[model samples]
Target: MNAGIPAAARELTDRLGPDAVATSGPLYDRTRRVWNGAVTNRPALVVHARGTADVQAAVRAARDHGLPLSVRGGGHDWLGRGVRDGALVIDLAGMRRVEVDAQAAVATVDGGATAADLIGAASPHGLSAVTGTVGAVGVAGLTLGGGYGLLNGRFGLALDNLLAADVVLADGRAVTADADHEAELFWAIRGGGGNFGVVTSMRHRLHRADPILAGTIFYPLPQAAAVLDRLNEVLSAAPDELTVAIAMLTGPGGAPGLGLLPAWSGDPAPGEAHIDRLRRLGSPAFAKVGPTTYSDLLHANDEQGETIGHHVACRTRSVPHLTPDTVSALVKAAATFTSPLSRVLCGQFHGAAARVPVESTAFGLRRNHIMATIISWWPPGDAEPHQTWADAVSEALARDALPGGYPNGLSPDDTTQIADAYGPNATRLRAAKTRYDPSNTFTATPLP
Candidate 1:
């Protein structure tokens, strides 16, 4: 037995079993891996928690040992808060369990379950969970930071669909948070990062959205300005069922180009009308707007073979409008950026997400807008160029954007923007942090 393993972990060795406690070798390396390959964290120990009881044990052990702690769900976060350099990581990947109550239209998902797991379970019953663009993203991390996805325009964000959550706090107390029970903690968890506790399970309200018309349209760089204007107009008046996401990239043969994905989650008749209009907005190099599943659309975002395991940095902003200046800036940035692996996406935010009152929940930014992400990726040793390029593009596009970026998009260095991320609900989040975690045991990110 390695004495390097903390004594606190030794206390629960029998209860959690040897396989659950990893300190070295391949298993330890596996537990340490996260979606972003750039995150290099070697924790003192990794606890592969199988249930809430195991989570409580890990929390108590960390607290008793006076060790800093972090939680790992899907480990897909850009900040890589899931597994830190020296903290003990509570690995929930083993606890992935998805239960669907079709009659009630709710999915009770374990924290470790990825977006793919939840969607695969719910789709069989013709119901769908509003998930992030990536299928590998952790449900807990995404929900806690206010999830955005293809269905967001129609059904609202993943946090907006969240009905309840089972949380294990720093003190080993497990509680179910919802509208009535532990309401403050519930509010805090909606947009607050995992500062208060570790969520064991989340009950999300599901929508009856399954197969829909969704695909991408590609056009030359010169046409992006008019196409973006038409898109702004179409989305400004379009119903909740139709959501459009646009990406600017260096297309085939290294030409500046644009790709758009219009996802409509309603009857084919009205949706076809909208898709036709969206297709006609620009002269395209190619177009493939057609019928498919939301799950398929989720994977389409990753079609370029660009994902975790690649050195990548992303910066995002929420813009009120695609003002001419913003459009020109985006075009110029795309034209100037040299990496083929990098991409810039502009997705519409409206319908239910926009109607939710700003103060009703912890997801503070309620206005209708464009959520833009500047993604940069490269090989291991050559990260500076990509990161610097992405930041420059983001800086250009952010002139007319809101002050705060999405919590999920914030990098590890962006602790100062926590208030902006929570907006009007920052005070409540701080108080809830005090009430639930006075000692601030979950130090992965800035408190409140």
Candidate 2:
């Protein structure tokens, strides 16, 4: 143990109230370990902020003591940036709150709320948020870093629907940033991530996304190439209401196969028509397609089955088209899956998501393109083989894929290529950083 941990913990508790402070104890270890079982970084203290005032106090303490501050919002990020050695963690899990304004078609979510929380709150109103494949992911992290979701084709990325946010800067001031106030920060957080400040709450526009036609269509390994060709054709010509994530994995039966998971947000009749066309693409070994709620679609891929104690890493590349060469390369990569839970996931950024301008937000890529990710997960003591396979897949795809990468799907090796992540927004994002966080207060992740 550190010689000064007790004194530091005592001073934090005295200033911030014991109820909201946690020191070196079982409780502290438990809190730090809850998020990512793979993250072993132990912070000196954890400030469990119950509200905005608590966040402000924690920020002041970090500034006063010159200690690094880690903002733990939902703490579901794959990178495990929530905890760091010798830092102070501002834990926001106690702040889960979501409110829906049906009349205005908007939903307000606290920084700590997960996508599942927001979906549950908004679904009763017959409205929905543009959330990702997993419902349990933190809304703040997903939205801020370009949320690709089932409804992305219909509405846009989650950040595109964000209207405003209440943020606490490095200097300890709580302020509102939106289109009308603190405009630069608003633009920055849309995709620049948690570099500007610690967000307290966020307001997002909602959409009518009920009665969706969503499910999976599985095909034999021999049909992968043909099915991908058909997938490329259908998604390119399909209406904005349709989006699909096609996965290649070793199924429960231990055989290589392809699964086309589609989501249609338009009227049921047309949605079924599109699904029918997709169903006819290849001779399927199995299929499950029918009516389902958008919320259910969001939770379909929640990684609850994978024990958190396993090492999880990911690599991604965006390509202009699912060319026959690209599809073959990806299928070949999936053959190297190290665990039953590991596989390749492919999707596209088109329709409403593609229409948004690159300059509109800090997200780098804004064109219609297909993306493939190698999700490599392995047990506690065997990350080498899985990570090596993922790296090989990444290098293989980079040859035919575009230059840029998706922030949420990038691995440690890929994120270091920051130019590919932020693109043209790099200059402006750094300028805004110079003005708002010159000292680089938020250093947990890759920032411009």
Candidate 3:
């Protein structure tokens, strides 16, 4: 055991054996890093949990020793909540196992499973799970927060598809939460995030995996305002099967442009008409709409995200409608990007996702709106300018934006944003947090 670690952490290493615990050295270094390169928090001990029992033990150890506790699923959180300074991390990286029940249309996914893992398993069975645009993100984390994706129009958000979850609570007790059992905890976990406990596994409802028309269409930067205006009009009456996400990004030859990514989950016959309508929005520099597999579509997004550099700063806003002012603000922000890697992404929330009653789950803002993500990134140097640019863009759009932001994208220190995001559900969520985790041992996304 490494003498540098706390005695409580060292005791945990002794019980789990050397392979399962990393007090220091190369293993600890490798497991400490998250998706965001800017985060450099180091845990006192990294417990590589392989199953539910291992997680239970880690929670017990952290509670008994009075050490801060954090859980690492896919370790893709932009905020890097998985690894905290001087905390004991229950690293679930080794627990990625996915089992699909084709007949029941449910997949049992381990806590560590990524969107790719679940997609790969379900696609083989001619099924698909609602996941975020990026495949590398953790399924548990995404579902615990509100998961937004192309399929959300046909299905609902990822949390809406969550059928059940196996959670290790603050007291180290294992329990299964679903609609029929521990209903309140079930509601809280749907959108309350990982505040209640460490989720070891989850059961997600899967939909039929059918090839649909999906791809991107890019337009010149000069025509962004017009394109956005037309896009807002088109989305107002868009069918439930079609979902489109708009991005102001640097395109080929490092030229700033507007890109629209559209996915249709229903029959391709009618989807062709919808694609054609979007194609005529503006004079496109490039378009690649066609019938493609969901897995391939997700892989394409993963490849695109990989190019945005390691260090990143992101801000988000929920706009009820893409008014002319909102469009102008986004275009202006894109024009003055601090780095070529900076971009503004907006995803529409509607159809099935919007139809769910607000009180049905803990997720706030159920009405149709656009979730704008302002992101800036650089190489490995200072990130002050990039962060400033993102924050400024967020402020500019605040006039036309909603009160709250996306919980998954918000930072822990954003107290006001957190309160706004939870809205009326804040009271019940706080009660659930107090009931299930009074000591606040697990802190994933900041609670309202």
Instruction: Please provide, for model 1 over 176-268, each residue's C-alpha lDDT reduced to its tens digit, 9 standing for 90 to 100.
Output: 999999998888888786888989999999888778898878889999888987788888897999988878887776887888878889999
* CA deviation > 4 Å runs, candidate 3: 1-5, 307-309
In the range 1-448, model 2's lDDT, one tens digit per residue, is 5555566567768877887788667667766874345677888789998889988888877777777889887667666677767888888889889999999999989999999899989999999889888777889988888888778888989999999999999998999999999999999989888888888999999998897899889887888888888788898886889998888887657887888889998989888889988889989888898998877776666643335666777788888888877888777876667777678888767899989999999988888887787787776776788888888888777777887687766645555456668889989988988988888887545763
TM-score of 3: 0.97
lDDT tens readout by residue for model 3, 1-448: 2343577667777788778888689989888887778888888889999999889889998888778889988777777889988888988889899999999999999999999999999998889999988888889999999998898888989999999999999999999999999999999999999999999999999998568689999998999999899888889899899999989999876989899999999989899999999989989999999999889888988988874337878888999988888998899888888888889998889999999999889998899999998888777897888888998899889889888899888996777788899867889999999999999887888777
Poorly placed runs, candidate 1 (over 4 Å): 1-5, 252-254, 302-306, 444-448
Model 2 segments more than 4 A misplaced: 1-8, 34-36, 303-306
Position 355, candidate 2: lDDT: 91
lDDT at 252, model 2: 58
How well does model 3 score by local distance difference test? Answer: 0.89
Cand. 2 Cα-lDDT: 0.82
Q: TM-score for each prediction?
A: 0.95, 0.95, 0.97
